[model samples]
Structures are given as structure tokens and as C-alpha cells.
Target: MADTGLASERPLRSASFRWFLGGQSISLLGSAMSPVALAFAVLEATGSAAWLAAVTTAALVPMVAALLLGGGVADRHRRDSVLRLTSVGAGLTQAGVACVLLTHQHPAFLLPLCAFSGVFQGLTKPALRGIVANLAAGRGIQRASSLLASVRNTTKIIGPTTAGLLTASVGGGWAIAADAVSFLLAAVCFARMSLPDRPQRTADDPTMLGALREGWGYFSSQPWIWAVTLAFAVNNGFNLGVWQILGPVVANGTIGARGWGLVLSARGAGALLASVVMVKLTVRRPMGPALASMSLAAVPLILLGAGADTLWLAAASFVAGVATEFFTVVWETVNTTHIPERLLSRVGAHDEFWSFVPIPVSQLSTPFLAAAFGTASVAVLGGATAAVAMLLPLLVPALRRIEIHRQGE
Candidate 1:
């Protein structure tokens, strides 16, 4: 495929990309709501945080385990078809959860249903990456990614609030039902998309294991890709633990829950603003800027450790959000432009899998670390570690050398 100049061809002008964007926007909104609704439903039914934790773990573990398999499947089939099937599967599982909640309220029933839903969720992730690359060739990748990020940030603001209202009025079951419907509707949109044909696999094609090994080889060979992935693996763990786990405790002592909520809102607003700005701006070489921006993430954690006022914390969070979103768009665009289409899903899966592997560890260990070293101390240390992780990628000469050119250039 020839490079499509960003000025000459806007991603939205493509009917297929429009369809993709519309479906993903709706689907993401529902996904954002699902966790809130599920949390309330689990509490209402079981009345135990332990059970809720178990249910949540059940869902997440399966998703993580399935990621490599999902990547393989996505690479083997049409990406859109994979999306359609996974959406249908996820929708059905959610419907089952709704039925279980509405009638018997068997908490154990949720385990299998949510586990299956998580599997479907895992399957969709890599296919989503592949489909976006297919729909937005060349420089349009950045525009498409920015547009998608904008919708995602907007939904993060709206979806939970909507779910809370629905849960309060009707019930958590009904809110989940709404999520199920959204997935099914998204499946319809996927069915309607017109994607280019993929090359047919021959009998001589490598087996799934072999294909995965091939993907691993390619991923490892690219210092820019693996280096960034390694940095994120460390940075995300510290960021999540400090910001999500310790920040709440710090808020209770200083800013209060309401203040914490406002700070989070500011972050979302900042991300949305960055997404809008990135639609017009072009970065020929994104990795250096992306890594540099990621260091901004440390500010809010350090502020919380310092016992800053709510306004100061919120200001830091807003900048962090802008930095996070900017890095995300640039990272996605880099992958789409540089990685071969055949291996894109596999590489993306590896990136996501490693990035997520440390999350559970952080979630599990943060409180222990806090109890031993004190919450404020841990937050400060975490922020410093994250900043180092983000900046360390700059030391890799290969990562710093990567560049993408505009079509006409």
C-alpha cells in the first residue's frame, strides 16, 4: 500500500475507518461502564469484598493467559472477523452474567461467565490494533489513534457516571445488560466494515508456536520497540501502585475523596485536550519525544508525597494526562508504521502482556511496601523510579535514531 499523505487524506474520509471508529467508541463506553456495574453487582449479591476480589481475579487471570493465543488467532484470520466473533462471545457472556444477577444471584456463576468474557476481551485487543493499522495507512495512523484516544478519554468521564445512575435507578443487572447490547451493536458495525483482503495462509505456513517464536524474534531485534516496552513494564507498575493505590490514602489524609475525584477529572481533561491537539500536529520522529513526555507522569506522585494541596495535585495530574496521551498516540503510530502487518498483532500482544504483567504485582505489593517504608516515602521513591524508567530509554542509540517521514517528504 502506498503512503497516504495526512494532508491529502483524512482518516475519517474513509468509510471503513469511520465505521470502525463509531463501533469502537460505543464499545469502549460500555467497557468503561462494565467494571463499575460489576463491582456494585458483586457487592450487592455477595456482600463480601473477598468474593469480589476473587471474581475480578478470575476475569483478569484468564485474559492475561489468553493474550498470546489471541494474538496468534488474530494473525491467522481476518482481523475484522476476529473482532466480530470476539464481540459476540463477550456480549453473550455478559448477558449470562446479567441473567445470573437478575434472578438467582449466584456469585459462583459469575466466575465462569466473567472468565469467558475475559477471554473474549483478550482476543479483541490485538485484533483491534491490526484493524486500526489496516484502516489508517501511513501518517493517518496518528490521526486515527488520536481520534480513538479522544473517544476513550471522553468515555472514561461519562461511562462510569452513567453506570452509577443506571445502577441506582434500575439495578446493576440492567446496567450490565446495556453493556451486552453495546457489544452486540459493535459486532454489527464490524460486520459492516469493508477491509482489504488478507493474504491466504498456505499448507506450508508455520504453526502457531512457530509463528509466535517468529514474532518474538522480530520484537527482540527492534531495540526501539523492546526498549520502550521494557521501560513501560517498569514505569506502569510504579505509576499504578503509587497513583492508584497510595494516592487514595494520601487523599484521605489531605485532599479528601472529592478532591481526588477532581484531580482525576483534570487528568482526563488534559488527555482529551492532547488528543485534540495531536490530530493536527506532526512528529517525524516520535520516540524521543514520547519517552521525554513520559517523565511528566512522575509529577503527580511526587506532589502527593509532598502533601500538596488539591489544586497543585490536580495541576500535576493534568500535565501527566497530557503527557500520557501524547506518548500513547506516538507509540501506536510508530508500531503501525514500522512493524510489518503480518507480525503487528503478535508484537502488540507481547507489548501489552509485558506491560500488564507487573500491574498485579504492584497492586499486590504496594500496601506491604507502604506499611514498611511509610506511604509518603514509597510514593516519592516510586515517582523517582518511574522517572528513571521513562528516561532510561533515551540511552539506547537505536531507539533515538528511529524516524517516520511524511509522505511528500
Candidate 2:
């Protein structure tokens, strides 16, 4: 490990950073509610796996499509400003969905509305990544990232259960409305933030396309970024996308709704524990360690596919969550140290786009695959594929050798 001086110090002592963290903590908690709520809502509305896949794919399409443009916009403008504006827009979109659903109307436009929300939310990604790197600079990016993940994981513990209960009691539409309110609150918090200015550019500076090209150039040149992203594209196909589509079904049928909530909370509990550990833990040769951690995440998938009892499944999910956070912290630390700050947002956008592009495919095909091969077979196959994919990037020497260094060192 390269010298990360004074790793013992905490970054949250900075008031502005604290506020940023606080706002995000609340926002993420609320945002966390949406996934379970939305999944169950669609499942209830149509009772078809295909409908769930379609809605999810609709949301991701716009998110993936607008990523490069979003990156360019974030790099060119004030990231804080971009974040605030996008947050408000996203809140409204979600609120709109809630109202439409609350009126007892058919969800004729849910897909388009979700797509619009995706666009706004997508634009915020590069800005969010840029903001974190700026605020955490030289104050121990690893610790800072770990702290952020800790906040999110903590919410993940509460959010799903909250959403599940609310869905059981009030309905998923209202739960989504709560997520909208959280976005608005996050927007207010963002509006109060102050950060260092970005680099000034003259009229002769690169066009949006030119900036995108530059970002792709930088991202592609880094063997670690591209290689890891390629692996994640496959990993996400199996883990995130497929899991999202199938989890609710599995949860409802086998585990019961409340039982599923407990299972998810168990996963979140493990993630929370991992993040807490990451706050004090620093690893050398992050690539190999990260991959090793990620390989363990497949355990829950295997257990779920086998229709293990709730207790065993939750235990496996908890362990998988712990392994996930290990990978997440190391990955963020590496990227923050390696990428140039000016291009971080754009590079992050490329990273997000490529890493997540396969999600819609994974989600869209999950139902068909499940129908064809049976959900158990699909789950096992996906989980096995993910385990294999996580290690593939290790074969690249550049990735394995990558290390972090303090900025001025």
C-alpha cells in the first residue's frame, strides 16, 4: 500500500463534509425505500415477471443513454449546482408517479415516467462522484468513502424493512412518494453546500463531444478501470439486475413478504458491519483483495437458488453483503486516487455506463430465462457466472499492480 498519511483522522469533522454526509445519509435511506417498493408495486400491478422487467429496463435505458452527456455537463459546470437541480427534477418525477398511482388509475405511463426520472437521476451521478472526491481530498479518501458507504449501508438495513412494512400497510405508491420527499430534502441540503471552484476553461476548450472523447481516452487508457468495469458488466448482469427482478418473487412465494424484508435486512446488516470495519481497514493490492471479496458475494445467490430456509438464506445474504462492502471501499479508494479530479466525473460516468449497461439486458432477459430454465436454474447459473467473472480482471497485470498514493507524495 502506498503511504496514506494520518489515516487515523476522520474527514467528517469538516462541517461542510458533515452536512454533505448527513444529507446523503437521509437521502439514501429514502432512496433505499424505492427499490423494494417499486418492485413490489409492479409485481402487484401486473402480476407478471415480464412487466417488472419492462419497467426496470425502461428506467435504465435513459440512465445509460444519457450518461456521457451527463458526465460532460458535470465536468463543464458546477457539480453542486447540477446535483441540486437534478435532485429537484427527480423528486418531481417520482412524486408524479405516486400521484398517478394514488389516483387508482392504470399505470399506463409508469414506464415513461420512470425513464424521465432515470434521466434526471443519471445526470446527478458524475456530479455526486465529483463532489465526494472534492470534499474528501487529502483527508483520507479511503476512510471518507468507507464512511459514506457506512451511511448508505446503515440505511439499507432500515430502508427495505421500512419499505416492506409501508408496502404491506399503506401501499408501494405511498412508499415511492416518501422517496420523492427524501430527494427534495436532499436537494435542500445540496443547495446549502459550498465547494472549491472547478478549473476555468476558455472558449477554445473542448466541446461536449470532445470532452467525452477525452474522458473515454483517460478511462480506456487505465487498464484497471476498463477491465474491472468489463467484469462488473457481467457481474451486475447476474447479481444486481437479475436479483432485483427475481428477489421479490422468491421472497413472496417462499419466504413471505415480511420474511423477505428480514432477509434483506440481514444483507444490509452484514454490509453495515463491513463498512464499519472498512473505516479502520486499509488493504494493499486492492484489486486482488477486492476481487476475492466479490467472489464471496455469490453465496447468497446459490442459497437463494436452492430455496434454502429463511434463516440460512439470510445468513448467507449477510455474509455476501459484508464481502460487497469490502470490494466497494477498495474500488472507490483506487478510483479517487487514480483519476484526475477534473475528469473524475466524466470518467465516473463512463465507468457507470459500461458497468451498468448490461443491467437492463440482464433484467429484461431474467424473466425469459427463468421461464425457460426455471428460476432456480437461472439463479444458480447467474451466481456461478458472477463468481467466475469477478476473477477475470485479475489476469490483467496493470490492474493487479495498481496502488494508491497520497496526492502530494
Candidate 3:
């Protein structure tokens, strides 16, 4: 028998999946441009990286907190409604940024606005994932996740490169306004989505708090989840700190501003190719070990830092992108498939809150780390530590059994 890529017999579900992918593709594109636009605007106006630095730092709290609270709410409420409402809120927020830009408003407003966007995301991201899990169904989850990774990479390609050109030509204000318009388009897509009834808790279940607690227990019971979540939090925090502290200085001051844009775009291109390759993969449940393996592959952040050139950086960036997408897709798909849908968002929050907990601290401290160790050395250390963290987990037998076949067994 010939195997068509179509996992489901029903055409309607397939159409819905396409619609979901289309919306996300548009959303990812605009988002990719945002950091480039924001950073450039800050530098051009104040002639100081301080504004960009401060807002990036300020964003950490609201993002993690909002994500936590939003996850709690998402588990208790209808995920569809939550996503719809937040998408509108996010669009309106972008509109406000656009209005500031359209009026030729001060660049001073940009950082705080970016921070606000972080708050908006904290509320919506969990629900977004929960919705995808519902939409993907069991058989289609891997493909759906892969499609998401590809779209994300595609946006990475479009966003930064476009922002670079746009900022160079039109000015930062207008580029920001373009991002705002993308959010409105995202809202329209969210409205058109028709999702199935969210998997409901059985009638005997208690309050939302009780439900939340149960999710906590369930996640805690899994040692590997806890271990990996901790590793990511620390690794992500450390990496972000380095990126924020060093990337701008290198790309703008040392490497050249255009270099930063190209470096970012190259990584996205790499991830896109990786996502395409992974989509056709079929294996018995092995997300856990795959995750550990890919995490080690991140060792090149060291190479990326030490090399730092068009050719060197691009090659390193490509490998890093491929590794990141592989781990991320496996991580998300495993979570979506294994965790009960009713508790999906809350569980996601639990994972995110803990895992991403170090981001703010890391972002805040990077400048100091760079000042103390020097940018190149600091980046090299971060990369080394991250690579070590990924492989050390092999000592845990639970992580070795992470394939789908062993989940909850």
C-alpha cells in the first residue's frame, strides 16, 4: 500500500490545519522583523544602546508572569476564546505602536512598547500551543509541529532581512507600523478558525486550582521533564544574556550592523531546511533521547562566537538552527501528545515558568558578564556551558527512555 502523507481520512481537518499554518506563517514573519526594528530605532534616536537594554531587561518579569497566569486561565477557560481575545489585544497593542510611529513619535517609546508586546505574548503563547495540540490530532501532531517549525524559520528569513531593508529605506517608525498591521491580519485568521471542543475534564473534577495542582503533580512525577526543563531555563537564560549583551555590539559596532541581520537570517534558513527533513521522519516515540542528542549539537554556539565572520558564523549558525528546531519540535510535540488536553495550558505554563525563569536575570547580567570576561570570551563560555548541560543529562536513565513508546509507562 502506498502511504500518502495524509494521516487523516477527513478533508475538513486537513483544511483547518492549512488555515492554521497560513495564519501562523504570517504572524511569524512580522515577529521576526520586530527585534531588528526595535534595536535599530533605539540606537538611531538616543545614540545609546541603553533604551534597548533597559526594555529588554524590563520585559522579563511581565513575560514570565503573564505566561504563568495566562496558562492558569487557559486551562480553566476555553482555549479558543482565550487565543481569540489575546490575538485582538495583541493586534490593538501593535496598533498603538504603529500610531506612535505614524505620528513620528519619539523613539523613546519603542522599548517599553516591545516590553508590552512581551506581556501580550506571555498571555497568549500557551493557549496558542494548546490550540495547536488540539488541532493536530494524534497522528498529525509531528507533521503539524514540523509545519510550524518551517513557518517559523520562513518568518525568520523574511523578518530580519526585510526589517534591515525597510529600516535602511523607510525609517524605523514605518517598519514598526508594518509589524502592527501583521497583528491585525493575525486576528482575522484567528477569527476564522473552527476548532473542536477542547478536551474537557470529567464532571467529578474539582476547581481550576485543583486541576492546576493535578497538572503539577503529573509533571512532577516525570523526572526527565523536570530535569530538561531546568536545563533549558538555565541554558536559555545564559544564552539570552550573551545575545543581548554582545550581539548588538558585535553586529553594529564590531561586526557591522548588516552582519547581524545576515547572521540571524542564515540561522532561520538552516532551521527551515531542517524542518523539511524532519517532517518525513517516522519512529517509535523517541522525543526524549532525540532532545538530549540535539541539545548537545548546540555546542556550536561556541564556534559561532569564536569564528564570527560571514562564512564561519553562517555555518555555525546553520548547525545551531538545525539543532534548535529539531529539539524544539520534538519537545513541543511530545508535550502536546502526552499531556492531557484539559490541563495542557497550565502544564505548559508550569514548564515555561520554570524553564524560562532565568531569562530576565540572564539578560540583566550579560552586560556585566561581558564587561568582566570580554564579549568574545563570555559568549564562548555560554556556548560551552550550554553544550555541557545538554549531554550531562544522559546520566539520567529516564531521559534515555524518552521515546513515545515509553511515555507514562
Which candidate's TM-score is highest? 2
lDDT score for candidate 1 against the true structure: 0.79
Least accurate 10 contiguous residues by lDDT in model 2: 1-10
Local accuracy of candidate 3 as per-residue lDDT tens digits, 341-402: 77788788888888777877776777677777877787788877776676665666867666
Please give, for residues 1-409, the per-residue lDDT of candidate 1 as tens digits: 2323442157887777777788888888887677667766676676554555567656776787778888888888888889889989999999998898778567998989989998998888988877777777766777888899999877766675666666656767887887898899999998887775678878999999999888888888988888888998888788764565566455544654346556766777788888999887877777898899999988899888777898898899889989999998888888888899889999988888777677656755676787789877888888889988999989999888778778566
Instruction: For candidate 3, list the clashing residue pairs, or say none.
Output: 285-403, 285-404, 286-403, 286-404
TM-score of candidate 2 against the unseen true structure: 0.95
| Model 3: ten consecutive residues of lowest lDDT | 1-10
RMSD of each: 3.6, 3.3, 3.9
On lDDT, the stronger of 2 and 3 is 2
TM-score of every prediction relative to native: 0.86, 0.95, 0.89
Per-prediction count of colliding residue pairs?
Answer: 0, 0, 4
Two-way TM-score contest, 1 vs 3, winner: 3
Q: Residues 1-409, candidate 2, lDDT per residue (tens digit)?
A: 1212242245665665676787788788888888888878777787888888888888898998888889999988888788789889989999988887677666667888899999987898888777667676653687788888999999989998898898888888898899899889988887777765667888999988999999999998888789989998999988778788888878867666667777888888999999999877766577898897898888788778888898998899899899898888888888877788889889999999999999999999998999899999999888999989999999999988987654455
